[model samples]
Target: MSHSAEHGRVRAGYNAVAEDYQKQIGGELAHKAVDRALLGVVVEAARGGLVADLGCGPGHVAGWLAKQGASVVGIDLSPGMVEIARREHPAAEFREGDLLRLPAADGEFAAAVALYSVIHLEPGELRPAFAEMRRVLRPSGTLLVSFHLGTEVRRLDEWWGHPVAIDFHFLESERVAALLAEAGFTVEARLEREGLPEEAATRRGYLLARRDAG
Candidate 1:
């Protein structure tokens, strides 16, 4: 499928399951101590500047960051998800936007987070997506991205009893880090851990990088 077509499927799929996903995953952070800690690092790095939660689903992470005093904005591809996020977390702003073409000005954010967001992008889209993230961030801005670790493309024809089409692409930490570097980010840290028992049985990788100052 073309990129636009694939994106449409993802958008439609998430829209179909937005409310259900919110109900099931909104409170997930409460049980993820490591995730919370990593987010905390982003909040600190923001230093009172704007923080963009790229591909934010349901705004739970953005709300959490807002409560920590970070100026937060949540961006998602699905309008349904954006609406639910706005309703559930009035403290932060939410907008419907594509990650490949973010709806923000250059150097608009001091930090950006894309937790499990890049998994939707096709292999060839990784570098461009990372470059777009870099374009929106100020020099030296922090970026934190997480995704499942492996080499598999998992397609779901149905999710949560909703008929939809979407593909989740697992990735390797080394490969992702190289893409980030090529997109003008300097890798600062990397973490790999087994999924929590209640979560999908897969390893997760997290990379923290900063936009090149030059």
Candidate 2:
């Protein structure tokens, strides 16, 4: 499919499933089991300031960060997701945007998160996507990205036949670290373990990196 068509398809798909996902899953799909730990890892690995939740579906993490006193903005491609996020968490700043090309300016944010969202990208799309993420991050900023451990892109998928777009591309933590480095980030921490209820698969992993301060 053309990228534009795919974008529209993805947009419509998430827009349709946005409310249902929140209602059915809530915090189940978030990395609640390891989110706190990952957060700690992020704080330790790099300086923190303006944080952004890229591909932030429903804005849960963004809300939590704002409560913790961090300036957080949640951005997602799905309008429905952004709407739901804003409704549920008024404290957070939510915007609809594409992860392939974040709307934020270069070095605009101090810390960033991809969470369970990157798994939706095809294998080749992951690297450039990370580069775009790196571009929006300030020097020495932290980035935490996660994925389900596997090797397949589940396209034309559905959530209750509502036409949800889910693509899971399993990859190694080491490989992700290499990509981060190529994208101008320094690898700092890595973890792979049991999946959270919000995770699409049973096994998941995350990589923490920092944009090179120098």
Candidate 3:
């Protein structure tokens, strides 16, 4: 199937459960630690350039990045999430697109953050997505990816056990590092954070990689 179709399927699925997604990942309610850690990387670097927030939902990360004085653009698969992002953050730009195949020019961003974003991609499908991420990032720019670490694919029953159909993927960080390296990014930082919400997969991995200066 085409990337668009796959994305559409995922989008439709999420759109049907957009509210649940919000409750799970609506910034402070969820993904709070991941958000702070990601923003720290950008702020500490003090770099200025386009930063793409792949799979950005409700524009939270993009809005935060923009508040930090970086140019931010957000993209998500779900139109419902995009609508919420637009509504919540009129200052930041949010559009509908696939992370596996973005609509922007190559080397356009100085940094990219996939905050718990790649969790939706199958493990084997990550290579192409990482390549596209590197393609849009300028040489030496950083790519930040955050996820709950695991060796197997698992599904949840519900958010608050509400019987919602929302679902996501979690991949091992080691495989992610390998894939990022294969995609032309030099691994800069790789570490795991513990003590995340038990409701989430406890192990969180944050990897910061850079495109070679070449």
lDDT of 2 at 100: 88
**Ten contiguous residues with the weakest lDDT in model 2:** 39-48
* Candidate 1 displacement at residue 107 in angstroms: 0.2
lDDT for each of the candidates?
0.97, 0.78, 0.77
Per-model TM against the reference: 0.99, 0.89, 0.86
* Best first by TM-score, ranked: 1, 2, 3
Ranking by lDDT: 1, 2, 3
CA-RMSD of model 1: 0.5
* lDDT tens digits by residue: candidate 2, 57-153: 8887777777666778899989999999999989878888988889899888988888877776766777889989988998888899887666655
Evaluate model 3: give its TM-score. Answer: 0.86
User: What are the C-alpha RMSDs, in order, of all predicted structures?
Assistant: 0.5, 2.3, 2.8
Off by over 4 Å in 2: 29-31, 43-48, 196-201
Which regions in candidate 3 have their CA more than 4 angstroms from the true location? 1-6, 29-34, 44-46, 156-167, 198-201
Q: How big is the positional error of residue 91 in model 1, measured in Å on the Cα after superposition?
A: 0.5
Candidate with the greatest lDDT versus the true structure: 1
What digit string (tens of lDDT, one per residue) describes model 3 on residues 23-42?
65666624466557667686
